[model samples]
Target: MIEMSWPQVSARRLERAGLGAGRPATGTGLATVEGPAEGPVEGPVEGPVEDIVAAMCGAHAQVMSAAEASIGLRADGVTRAHVRAALWGEGRSLVKTHGPRGTVHLLPARDLPMWVSAMSSLPGAHTAAPKSIRMTAEQTDQVVAAIREVLAPAAMTIDELSEAVIAATGPWAGDLVMPAFQGWWPRWRMVMHVAAHRGAFVFGPVRGRKVTYTAAPELAPVTDGLGALVRRYLAAYGPATPDQFAQWAGGPVKWAAQAFSAEELEEVVFEGKRAWVLAGDTEVPADPPRGVRLLPYFDAYVVAGRPRELLYPGAAAARALNGGQAGNFPVLLVDGVVGGVWHQRRSGSKIDITVEPLGDLTAAQLRELDEQVDRVGEVMEGRPRLTIGPVTVGGHA
Candidate 1:
């Protein structure tokens, strides 16, 4: 086990490590995440691009909604539009649901069924309340039946579903499904439950209009296919422990452990930590491009698992990653390690980037920052106009 300093790593290093000119790198291997810049974004011959694209599509299979796909990709440096382009080649619907931990997340098309099953296992809170507010078993059954009926045919908007629940349970709507949390209505909790049980799939939630929903199919049958999906995740963002897998998969620790029990995975030491790596992943790029990238909130690099301390350090990781809220910050990646913070805004064709370095960087660091910013502009279809903040040159503001 060899320990490497976190300060020496940056996002660009991670991106270019062990990547090849062709797509075979992604086929069931430990391939680093890459975002091609200077070179034309083209794959090798013999249907490399299409095959990899198809594989990518397969990895996210069963995902009908775009909103869900967008968020997942956005976590990984791709934008909502990028996901749409990959899926429909034209804009279309995606799925979103109130996931575990009382938050909504974009479900990956391929992993939706497994995710649904894992989420369903979490015991609902509606049954444990006091007699004055507790939902009896019979009442719970009635609500479940009603929800099944309403969702059997097709999905419904939140408003429509709420109305249907209200209609089915009659006056009990205000008390039964919408229980009083110790006497006060827990609307958010109710919404999460309703969304979960219906097996409802979400499409693009048009800006201000109602979000469209549709009946989700029996995702259980297809869930067996997730073996490859899990492999892909581990390969793409790996060197992770089982506990990390459990957290990322939204499943129990036992299940997370089992997901990787299949052949093709090997535990390896990354920076001295016992981390799993895909057997197929071979190349670990040395002397990767040093660049600074301004990542969006909730970027995949930050949200992959619970190891901010591994990614950052003691006090800094604690403050920046508060219960996974690190996604909210505009992260600065210099040399693959999170170096500082950056703010970005677009004004017409010009994208303004303001970088605040946590410490003094070498000349090589500035060059790396330029490379990343250029990529961001290309992805966003804008011109790069960087404004280096004085914070990096001086002390913290």
Candidate 2:
């Protein structure tokens, strides 16, 4: 019955999010049992792309590895198999769904048919471009067709894909090509995929390996059925306003609201503002472990929201949410908040992680950091080394 400020509400509201806890062990059943209100899971788990995206609504898959993204999502009940099934279900091709500032994302393997149906009805694709390039709908459609033909059989790098499209579409194609098409063509050559039912495209390799993209046949006919999943996104990340949904959705707010508002959602006031949550999502245990997590810059977990205040300090939040505006740097999490930053440089089988704690680390905390570095080493092919560096809280260098 009392009014609360955003900070106070944010602090209390996010306190229950359970984001900073490191990866939970398998069989822990953290998510299946009572854990956090955000869903279930103590730490993160590795899973396929689509499953993870389905559970989380939005995923940072474009930038992070399947393993890396899974590690983060395990903390919230999403798994690799789930992600995989979403992308390549039933051995059929999936469609790419583009929204939220025009970047294309992967949709569930089983959900493409309906997604494409709904999206095709919408007009005007948001072409993420610099001030110079302008393209008409007729031109855009032609390019899309040209690119599709080039990418239909096999995956090609962005350059290869672009060359093929240009050869067919003519020189003017380069001037009129939108950034999404430019970004997507290469991925299409690599392997076709769908982003939440919008369109079909491909993804390139990550960490020196070509990332696999696949489509699902079952999802092709259920355009109207995806309303359930849209509502799911709102509940898990909501209590947020519709405007926030639009931004996070990477699509028009009008469409996102229409998708989400079509269902039954529970409303709650979190951090002093109105919010909507899924009717059945349970709360996690209040007693969270004093855990630490290392998150990459532009990682989806933190970027899913419009503002970073829910999970980061004011200054740090601004940099993280720049929306591809700045370079991504790895971050250190002490408990659930960003307490410092870290960087690594590899030389001769050694990956040196230069740790810059916001404050001095306790001996125990230091040891924990060391263990985490070991995991990073595994990720970087078994060369684990550590370094101590001096840095301000928000400073990257």
Error of 2 at 245 (Å): 2.1
Report clashes for each candidate as comma-separated counts.
Answer: 27, 58
Model 2 CA lDDT for position 333: 66
- Cα TM-score per model: 0.64, 0.67
lDDT of each: 0.48, 0.48
Residue-level error in angstroms, candidate 1, position 313: 3.2
Model 2 agreement with the true structure over 1-397: per-residue lDDT tens digits? 2333334433322333334343333323222211112333332233333333444443444443433443433444344344444444554222334533444555444444444555544446454554355455555666667755666676665556667777887776654333353353222222112232335454533324544332223322543544544554443454566667666644577876676677666666666666665554435334444656565544444545434564556555554434433225566766555666676666877876787777677888888788777766654454767887853334232
Model 1 lowest lDDT segment of ten:
33-42
Compared to the true structure, candidate 1 yields what TM-score?
0.64
lDDT of 2 at 137: 57
Writing each residue's lDDT as its tens digit, candidate 1 over 304-388 gives 6335765555544643454545554556655455667666666888877777777777887777678667756655657877777
